[model samples]
Target: MLSSLAAGFGLGLSLIVAIGAQNLFVLRQGVRREHVLSVVAVCAVSDAVLIALGVSGIGAVVTAVPWLLDVVRWAGAAFLVGYGMLAARRALRPTGAALHVETEAPPAERGGRTMVATTTRTAAVLTCLALTWLNPHVYLDTVFLLGSVAATHGAERGVFGVGAAAASLVWFAALGYGARFLGRWLDSPGAWRVLDGVIALVMWGLAFSLVLPVFTG
Candidate 1:
């Protein structure tokens, strides 16, 4: 049991530690300190649910329906491409910090113009959901691959799944909360531009990943 648990935890961390679109989005939100908790919660919970489903043998059912995977692949690619374009636009026009949370000051102290960030709490959460759920690779990795591994554990699959879920919780919590420490360096618009550019690249890369295999195969 302990060996399977350790194996699950290690594998889960290895799979999720990649520099992907979802991780980039979480890091950006963490740096901005906007809806970090909600974003982290959504990511961790979504992973947990998927891992549970995989361990429960539902992955077999999902893979049995190849058409559903096709739908998810196309939708996920479209969403990623759209998001990547939006991020690229932001990068091209680098702006100052978007102050979503403002302090109430006197009219004289405060400028008449609202210096709000383009992203809202609702939008941030929706984006988080899309990034988590709309990625077909996520299902392939978390559900199908992990499920197959868990099945090898026989009766210990439940414990293995729990360990994997714990890894997700730990990783997201660390990433989402730890990103604020990078604020000192990203204070300038130039830094933000670079970050946004990288995010755009990550998003487009994920989109291409979804599309490439279909054409290649």
Candidate 2:
């Protein structure tokens, strides 16, 4: 049981600690100090739910319906491309105070621009959900791959799932909270532009990778 728990924790962390859209979004929110708790909760809870489903044998059902993944693949690609364009626009023409830390100043004091300071909680939460759910890779990694590995534990599969879920919570908490330290360095609009530019490239690259398999396969 101990071995199974350790294995699950190690594997889960390894799989999740990669550079991806979800992690990027979380990092941005963390740096901005905007809805950090909500974003982290959504991501962690969503991962736990998916891991539960996967450990419960839902992976087999997903495999049986091959078309499900195909549909998700296209949708994910489209969403990523759209988001990439937005990021690119931000990179090319960032607002002067866009990356400034939020303050209690009124809109008039802040040049009568509220949107430049921070996004709505609803928007942030929705974007977080979309980033997590729309990506087919999440399903593949959490539901299929992780599930398969958990299955090898036999009767201890439940423990393994618990360990995996725990890892997700730990990782997201650390990432979302720790990113605020970088906020000082990203104070300048130029820095934001560079960051957004990299985000745009990564988003487009991931989108292309998602659809490339369709063409090749």
Candidate 3:
């Protein structure tokens, strides 16, 4: 049971450790220090739910539907392309002073408006949901793939699944909150542009790789 759990934990970490769009978004949020806790918590919770669902026999259903897999593959590829384009645009666009949270005055000084403060939290939650749900690869990774793997363990399946879930929670929480160290270097607009440009390249590369197999085959 322990060995299986360890294997599951390793598998989960391996799946998530890639420098993908979701991780990049989390890292960016960590650097910005904008709703870091909420963002991490939402991401962890979402992953845990999906991982649990995956281990609960949903993998069999997903495997039975090959079309679902194909749909996810194509949709994920397209989303990656779109995100890459957006990142490129940001890199090319002139740097404007976006609202830095630290610079904001107290609500009383700002006309007693609660809208901006509330909106940030709302946006953070929405971003987490969108990031979790939009990418079909997440479903593939957590539900279909990991679930299938856990099925073979029989009695150890529960332990394995829990281990995997723990891994997802740990990784996202660390990435979402622990990445603040990078903020010292990336606080400047120029640094942000450079980082975004790299992200764009990575996204485009992954998208191209996804489609390349189809054409080559």
Instruction: Judging by TM-score against the true structure, name the best candidate.
Output: 2
Alpha carbon lDDT of each predicted model: 0.85, 0.87, 0.77
lDDT per residue, candidate 3, 65-161, as tens digits? Answer: 8777677667777877887897798788834543233324453233243312223878777756765776677898999888989998998988998
Residues 49-90 of candidate 2 have per-residue lDDT tens digits of 999999998999999999999998888889889889998998
Q: What clash pairs does model 3 have?
A: none
Q: Is candidate 1 or candidate 3 better by TM-score?
A: 1
TM-score of 3: 0.80
Positional deviation of 180 in candidate 3, in angstroms?
0.8
How many residue pairs collide in each prediction?
0, 0, 0
lDDT of 1 by residue, 1-217 (tens): 9988988898888889989878999998887777889999999999999999999999989878998988999999999999999999989986655333223533222345444456788999899999889999899889988888999999999889988988888999899989877867876678788888988888888899898989998
Which residue pairs come into collision in candidate 1? none
Alpha-carbon RMSD to native, per candidate:
3.7, 3.0, 4.4
